[model samples]
Target: MSGKGVLVYGEALVDIVPATEGRRAEAVLGGSGYNTALTLARCGAKVAYNASLSRDTMGKRFRVRMAEEGIDQRFVSDCDAQTPSATVESIDHDGAASYRFRLSGTAFDVAPPEPADLSDFAHLHVTSFGATLGVSGQAALALMRRAREVGLSVSYDLNIRLPVLPPPDQARSAIEERVPFCDLVKLSYDDAVAVDTGSGQDYERWFAGGLPLVLSTSGDHGADLYLASGGMISAFVPASEVVDTIGAGDSFMGAFLASLWQNGGLGPLLRDLPEEISASAMDFACRVAAETCGERGCKPPRLKPKPPYD
Candidate 1:
């Protein structure tokens, strides 16, 4: 049977933000996978999150929030250890935020592999954190292997958090290792530059490992979609007024996937989407991301159906 939903596998943790005053900061439950899963669910996609969570209060709260957001939690597992946590300072002058993570030895650090039945999902999204964490890395790889075995489409968001990986070389290696396995790979302009250098042709070479599709987003400058089929398709959707840029990329990813699924064009769109169709899809995603930035935290407002295209 063909799968009807997307499976999102990775970490779910608390984001602790320091208050402006000397008061204690607030902790919001979030992670790259969590954010993407929530966005997908909000956009009306049937999504299931598979991740390890601690028995701590933060973890429990995360589970409750997932249910409230209509995301399936059957695949989530709870452990005795603490959930992963990251502390974010205030926004920088450029509206970018910096984070310091405390994830070592945490429950999410040792994610267990999902059951073979997980292949029932139509698509799987694995993030950089899932593939770079300790035991979680092995588990994620196992899950990816199984997904591919079942002929499920795989996508990876190169959500590179420099602080987590420490050295630049290590981060690049970790990201490059997962590219060949993904049918769809997404990266930021900053991340693309960090992984390779040169002109557009050279950038295409970096993605030449048969990834099929490469999406690179440049804040304010808009996004570019590279198809292995032929020439590049570009979208210059200007960024809306900024609030906080956190989770904007995840929102874009979720919207893109949802659009592909709804239109029954996942494979063709990834292989050879027409310029106009590709631009419209990317533009809708960009709008979703911009709306996400308008909010204080990672969770964006619910998505509504757009008017039919000409």
Candidate 2:
């Protein structure tokens, strides 16, 4: 009983932006996995989200948002705990936003039941706090292994949050253990440094470790894609006005996967990826992320309609 589309596995939570001047604090839909699913669905990729949501107001809002965005929710289950939240820190001049997460005892701290089958998905994408801590972390690790056993493609986004994660040494050890299960790994340069301080600013080790692609996004300086075939593609976002850089990386990962999947390259990405495909996908991903940065929060932009022809 094979199925189509991607399975997104991780936490689903809200981000509370602090009040500024006349505006009051606002709660926005967020979480790496949820944002990725939104971006994927908006980019025209079929997506199924697998997060256990609480029966609270925030969780109800999440359900509405996902439904409005056209995401599949059959895999989403219910939990008795309260919804998790992250308080957004001050935004820097460059628009980079940090966070202080309230995750302990939240719905995400509890692992959802396993999916009935792995054949219901073609690709699996995991990320963020849920992928690194608590019962959810164990579930994520097990799901990744199951995906591999079913021959499904997998991508891991190391969107590490130092404040909420374990010590660097333990965090690094945990993340490295999951790398071998990934066909593609996406992380920020800061996350890379946090993972392995001695990586010497080079991600070749990840590429050489059997991953077909290792993508690292550096704010403003743009993103770098390292290929297992010893080739590198660097993409720089064109200068654009910024709002807040919340969810920028999640949008990038989602768009990158969407581009590959839409262009018929996702399934064979690890087996035989053409240089042209990687280059095009990277460019598209950067453009989408840039658009997201212009928005207020994690609200990713949809692909613009093509101009009518004569």
Candidate 3:
């Protein structure tokens, strides 16, 4: 899949969210990879989504949404299996969510488009189901390996689902395999804890060795950025009118990548991007997430003009 902008590799699932307490759930087009692509395109980045899309109704809706946003769908492959979906149940007054997956293993299969198929892409963003589940996990690993060989800047999100993935010990082993392939990693505090108790020096030590950067989000507490060459940077959640937090993190990632892509640099940016440049990316990301939270569901707004740094 050749592209001018970022290519997001992962699952494109429908999010069946609760419309009213104890009432029927409304199915919405979502998934970290799809949401990231949608947000990036709306932000005016030339983006493409590479995934195995089901030919079912939900998959059709998802593809239509991508086209409507002007995101290229040439890399998407069609399948006959049922589209995977997440049945979401919100918890507490904050509207934070708990999810249960209905999986069909009907996500991306990496047989076609050989590595040479990828051309002229500025970046690759990977996350969610395709990064960890059965065939999806292998697909992600293959693409990451190819990206490495072809010299494409890469980012990953450990959007871990505890109930759906393997046991903790096994999950860590799986996660460890992909971390080294990424220049940037975005994982939530919950993911950090669920994946490896995320409080130990082990994670920092690993980052120090392989990963160039990581953004660890702590829900309402904002996020912390760890840089390989520099110390940690922090950004607090800017105050905003609260809405359900669905897709907030994905929006953060979308704006984050958008900042780096459009930043005026001809040479590779992720590996040696200046300290301030990365910090500015976080600030923009945090604002994007906050704005997404202000709206219901995962509707990421168009990227506003870049704001002055704090």
Q: Candidate 3: where are CA atoms >4 Å away?
A: 1-3, 21-24, 105-115, 264-267, 305-310
Go through the candidates in order and give each one's C-alpha lDDT.
Answer: 0.73, 0.82, 0.76
Residue 149 in model 2: lDDT: 85
> Which lDDT tens digits does candidate 3 get at residues 151-261?
888888988888788898888888778878888878898887777645547557767767777788987888888877767888865747766888888988888777666
Q: Which is the winner by TM-score between candidate 1 and candidate 3?
A: 3
Output the number of the lDDT-best candidate: 2
- Using TM-score, give the best candidate's number: 2
Tell me the deviation in Å of residue 179 in model 2: 0.3
In model 3, what lDDT does residue 233 have? 82
Q: Flag the better candidate by lDDT, 2 or 3.
A: 2
Cα TM-score per model? 0.89, 0.93, 0.91
- Report each candidate's C-alpha RMSD, comma-separated, in the order given: 2.8, 3.1, 2.9
Model 1, residue 58: what's the lDDT? 85
lDDT for 124 in candidate 1 is: 82
Clashes of 3: 0
Better of 1 and 3 by lDDT: 3
- Model 1, total clashes: 0
